[model samples]
Target: MALFYKSNNAGVPIGWIAIMLALLASMGGFIFGYDTGQISDILLMEDFKLRFATCETPGVVASCDFTVVREGLIVALLSIGTLAGALIGAPTADYLGRKYAMIVECMVFIVGVIIQMTARHVWQQFAVGRLVSGLGVGALSAAVPMYQAETAPSQIRGSLTATYQLFITFDCISIGARDIPGAGSWQTVVGIGIVWPVIMIVGMMFMPESPRWLAKHDRIEEAAAAIAATRGIRKDEAMSHPVVSKEIEQIRNHVQYESKMKGGWLDCFSLKDKILYRTLLGMSLQSLQQLTGANYFFYYGASIFQSVGIEDSFITQIILGAVNFFCTFGGIYVMERFGRRRPLIIGGIWQACWLFVFAAAGTAVDPEQNDSIGKLMIVAACMFILGYAMTWAPGIWILIGETFPTRTRAKQGALSTASNWTWNFLLAFFTPFIVSAIQFRYGFVFAACNLLGAVVVYFFLYESSDLTLETVDQMYCDPECKPWNSRHWAPAGYESRHNLVEQTKAAEAHKPIVGGEESRREDVEKSGDEGRTERC
Candidate 1:
């Protein structure tokens, strides 16, 4: 909280424009989180279970007779649409700027919500509705963070991006809505989730386009204006603002370099230039982020509570949601302070330990009779959520958002998000069966998965702290750079050259010119082009 209010050493507070971008973009995250959280509670509803009934076992209650696979399908349908949307959204985001892509996502979400709210007859309609809604969810997931990353300053980038997860934790409030009585309550939950997306669409109309995206397409004037607006400076004043000028120069340099490369989706897979290797690492990192098995807790936490003989599982969910929501603050703080890799390794270890405790407790005590063990299981689950919310949940997005170069960013974002959703689909699809078949022992599976994730983090993950996005790009572009070797590596003179660009701008700001403003503009543009060539 103090960090949000504090200014930089030069006494410049973060501009409201950058803050607004983060806030509006994060609404997409809230909507995504709401859908994720709501479904778990909906799944526990008797009405929702009966509406999607596929089995008819004699003497079984209608809800009780719902088959495991069918229930899993109902819960997992959203991820299927998410997988498709994330794959296609990259090309769409590149074609349409990030802001408009988000607007398009909102419109799709509205259509999906209408379909869901109006469903009268069958389970298929409900599933179709979830799939449609998921397409929008997937698109927003890919676009929003990319937009936020491009807009934020490097100093607070981790915390600002982590706000996406903070807004996600806001969905915990939706858990309380589950107690709404009557058969139509689930419909109400679905309808209510639309509020944040609507706000996001309207609010985005007033935000600036990403400066980096503008520069990528050679819209230099617009890019400068966007940077000016983001910095709360006049267009003329922007040329002398050291941080803004340096960033604009770096973006221009990167874009110029990209223009010389073969820019296409398939270019991302070129092994000759090591693009393929970098892409694979990003995709695998995302997969490991999901395969950490966090969503299993999100999707089936209610059932886990029930297995431990807690009668009012909704209340338990509320408690869990609160724990998740509050603990996320710890995550936001450590992300910038600890960098990205170490905290993840530490969190994975914590998650594995708590899950093992939960599993062992379940095995040792009969949940139906042992109140103390039931409480212990709940505590362990909350502890697991704490570890995850503070680490992988926020850290993965920050790392992924900053990983790829501008040329391959959208495609890599699409690929990375697609990998995440694919694993999400599989886990959501199979979790019920895993829990039912293994009972308490299912905890061992995720515990082992967390251990694997920790091992991966230790061996393969690299630290990406206090560096500009351009420098990070250059690091990856180097032929000698590998994932494990990144910690010790430094690209030559990029920082000093960046400072020189800023110093030159500040010096020129004080000079008198015969050609006036237009002449200076031409000189700046020419200098930018030459700098691009020299840097390349």
Candidate 2:
């Protein structure tokens, strides 16, 4: 209810190396956002409709049921493909590791992009291309956050991962193309979408695999080297650093515990395991993000505005795009400084208010005759977007990334991301029908969903902000852990919360130089033992 600030009391600085890795992994998000934003406007284009929708006239709406169905499929198939990608990306990420899995995503996205660009037909080939692109989107969406969260320090993990959505908002790039004419422009824009994935593929060639993943795999030495590279420190120095060594130890302990316990989808549903609780929290929140009618604004912004009697929905969409883009910084700052729980609650309330207002305004007057009511609808829609952009949009990614223990992170992340796209596909596919059936009252459905989502956020969501990944693992293992009361929580002894510089200084000062290399190794091991004890 009040401002909850989680600072880096440990004085751990996020180095440029970590930032570089976060940014590179975030290219997947760029592709995700670009595809969503690009399609929103392109579906209305004359050439797009002619080639795909088979409509007889330029700038005319698809009136028949068949045309509407085709349009929906074109828009929704990408999500279908993404759904598949999330499913496959899970095991792929687990088996191949995050970096290589993303390289595969890039290749998939490239193939999809080429198919979409070259397609001369509508439902069959065009839909196939979209489904392929969605596969890339799904994989990237699953892999990027997992990669970023594992690589990042807990202090900035929220903001670093939120950069994925920031790229989504920045994906407002092709909004300008709406002003340009012809199908070639759309093709060129789709081609441009290929650049970010290509960047991800090429850039990942040089990036380190997740250190936590390596530690889990019993490659402790390589994990230490990766930790060193991530912090721009020497490998020997990293192996000896108390904080880095503690991180490795924590990863090892959690992985060991997970290995001892059998895991599967059944494990995720079992009341015997606290992990199932975390899984539901993440999956539900991700589902809520889409159900809150956020994508209705995204996938069908023009249609929603058009239904409310706005003549030039394209320009208005561009304006909303800009609004969505800039407001996301507020989310990033909030996620970093204020933690995750409060912003979500606040955003949910704010969204419910705007959505109800939109519904009221939509029904208040004839959009066909009353221009003022039409303008109000636009205003209400923008406010709704503003609320969503700052809260659920970015917060869902932050939650999903940090929610599960490393043992189930990939598979759980895949399930959570797939829930999002599944709901996304449903909303994108049925929005036209929902809009037609409910008319101005559709906002009411969204408003009610958001209000329900807030209750879930308060009762089910826990605070993981500013906690080390290792500490979070402990939070779930305890029998007394409660989702509703986690804001005031901390692991006993709290070793991971120490000042990084102080810890390093103390470890260095205790080095036994008289016994040479073996003594130094013993000191490092001793410090690591103490760190584990303090953390537990």
Candidate 3:
């Protein structure tokens, strides 16, 4: 029962650990995709019809056709639980640590799976198991990436974190493949959903605690040991590495400093400076991604296909899943190379344009002529997928993790993630209403949202590529650089743990350690100064 650890030694190959951890934790995303994707197919089943008919009001018979009203309510209710879980997850992770929070989420997921598997009624399953699982998925959506980002070495952080989306796409494909026979046997399809979280729980038994969490809790030695074990390094070698030692030291100093600051929810809002701006930016990024109508496809793809007169909706689901998978790879390849902001700007515009085309096709075509229009909309949808797969989806998480200071990282990550789930709920809940109300014009709503998202990105977001975390903070905190200013400052290598120690030492000379607030101010000032000085 040896625990896995990340290696601190140079050239020891940390990529494998990164990939392994990413793949394991990403089971959360898999659960999300499977549960969400399976619903569309389940709604098409005879079993679902029979179940719904039993609960129908008196003479009201349930229809075989999937109604946007029922579909939207189910999806929206799941999101409601997700929103609550996400909000709670921040505090849970902050207090219990990411690993333990994930463990608890596993239990929640188990409850959800069992309920969904055995439920005799659709409403019972939806109200009980689906909502329970949604809570687990929502919390994991926030926690897993935070855990991975905190645990992953800086070199491969983006790729490792992006694996969440990869697993999500993989889950979509798996669920779709399982449903190829259509809604006739939803029991089999829904049953497959339990496999992922069960695997994750088993994996958790083998995985080590997050080193960053260890560092935050004043357990430097344990943190170092955990890193060494996970990275396959000798404990002594890991402890001796200057980079590892420096990071551990900085974490200790940062945590000790935070211990003094008046810790409360108000603190997140009180900082009207750059920190506040960045926090809002992160929250907005998550919301914008949802508003762009991406998850709508994941949740309602089968219905969308049905709308286009496709007889075999499961086939379309598989195609969408494949398209999502490759398109996400396209995003991964370009993220680091081109930087964060550019890809988002470009991708947003492209997505907006294609959404309009999708809308136009959907609106203009009659059922008889849907053959050509459906083909066109499918291509347009793929293009939209390519645009989002390349930008926003993965990049937003990268920016959120990197933009915040280590002191507030977990809390901010949680808050922004909660915002994401809230918006997800909004979209999921309203989408059926929108589709039913507008009929073929639903694509227009998505197109408009994408356009709005594009505008927001262009005006509010900045380039975060190649800049170390510390440097990015400086760009936000520096008073001279107004919010509207377009000036870009090249940050130095201040992100290295060794550099932080030097900066901390320099700060110690200027101010006596009176309390946590004073000490934290000193660290923030020092980190900011270091970033500025290096740029000069």
Candidate 4:
């Protein structure tokens, strides 16, 4: 059962199976992105209007479009549902395990889709269906990444976890291109997402469970098998494999540390352990990710383009979506190539500059009357998308996954994600009114947010790049290691882990043991300085 593999830049085994597992888990993002982009086009479809967009206000003569409240409710209800779901997702993921939690959420999303498909009667039906499905989307957002972050090797974990955002950007572009030029039953758009969750269920059936999750639940044998399967190690020697052995030790040690603290939700906010600081940091990052205004376009791109006088605005939207999608690959590269804060801080200033131009261009003329504003807005929008996709979109998710300790990751992740949805909901609900009142000036608000986000990031967000998650927990434990100077900080545990891994590598090649073989096992188990060495 030996499977040969090449090592990635991070020296982890590179196997197609592991890659596919990340891709499959990332289908949750596919569904989420579809829902975000799908409705933007659907809301503009004449068929949708004919069926559900009758004037809520008493108009004198003909039927009219949905009232502001109704439209806002339709779009924002999902976020509300997701808020609850993100909160609930933590316990569900913990109780059920990451793999099965995803399966269950996928099913829930499908059932919500069924309800959405049947909604020809009124807008409420469709909106309710969206709200119902959001529960799954929200939970999947938490669980899928948790699974990916847990199972992926540290070397490519950022790239692998960023696949979730990749699916998001990819599908948002794909949906905008596929459905933007068409007019049909909105149900078709709703139904298409069912395919994603279905794929998730099928693919996950064959995937390994998160080894960390198994370890957390005290399933050591199954955890080793999971490591073996994912890392391409032989199952017989998987437990004794140096990397695997060290990883298992770290997980056990961390879990025991957590148990000793006996922390719960309150612990997440308590200053005594500095958990409060991390909770706020994760929440702020998530909130700022939304405030960056990328979702503004995906959620309402058509309306924005139409306001700027592009008659058939969908093509312009498709171009922007394409840029957003392609630049996200650039984001994956940035995640691997640089530390976390620099890109985001630079992207913030970049987005702010473009958004300022966008607002100024819109304010300089009547966008409805002047043809030039169209090009300017598109240019500005594209620039904004480029910066955001490469930085905050993937960076925030990557940060949250690495920021919190394993003991509190699920709940704390939900808190930050809930912040994402809350801001998402606020912007979704209020943007129409805001855009109508100030028009392009609305860009200024997010531009300001982007700037503030940069400053906050400079002062607060810890750099976790290139460090393993276990190393991340230990790094955060140090009182002296603040965000400003964290790049130079490494926990002693990290050096020990690296030394052990190097020893394991030497052991693999039957290289001479530095202190002979008899004491190696004792050295590892007890950190005993006693003169002995043993086989890895």
**Number of clashes in every candidate structure?**
0, 2, 8, 7
TM-score of 4: 0.88
Q: Which stretches of candidate 4 lie over 4 Å from their true place?
A: 1-10, 55-64, 172-184, 303-309, 493-536
405-429: candidate 2 lDDT, tens digit per residue = 7777888898899999999888877
Error of 4 at 46 (Å): 3.0
Which candidate leads in lDDT?
4
Ten contiguous residues with the weakest lDDT in model 2: 1-10
For all candidates in order, the CA lDDT equals 0.75, 0.76, 0.68, 0.76
lDDT of 3: 0.68
Score every model by TM-score. Answer: 0.86, 0.88, 0.82, 0.88
Candidate structures ordered by TM-score, highest first:
4, 2, 1, 3
Better of 1 and 4 by TM-score: 4
lDDT of 3 by residue, 1-536 (tens): 12222222212235355567777987887787777766766765666655653444533335344455666666566777787787778788778888888988878977887777677755656556778887888888888888877776554667767778767776443333443553336667777777788899888777767887787677788898766655555677767754455445545555554566644565665464355777788898888888887876766666556656775767777778888878888787677556677788788888888888877877777534567777777778888887888787788777766766656766677778888888887777777667878865777777887777777777777665534444455566555544334235433433343443334333323333323465445453543334343321
Ten residues in sequence with the least summed lDDT for candidate 1: 1-10
**In candidate 3, how many Å is residue 225 off?**
2.7
- Our model 1 lands, by Cα RMSD against the true structure, at 5.6
Kindly indicate the candidate among 2 and 4 with the higher lDDT.
4
Q: Name the better of 3 and 4 by TM-score.
A: 4
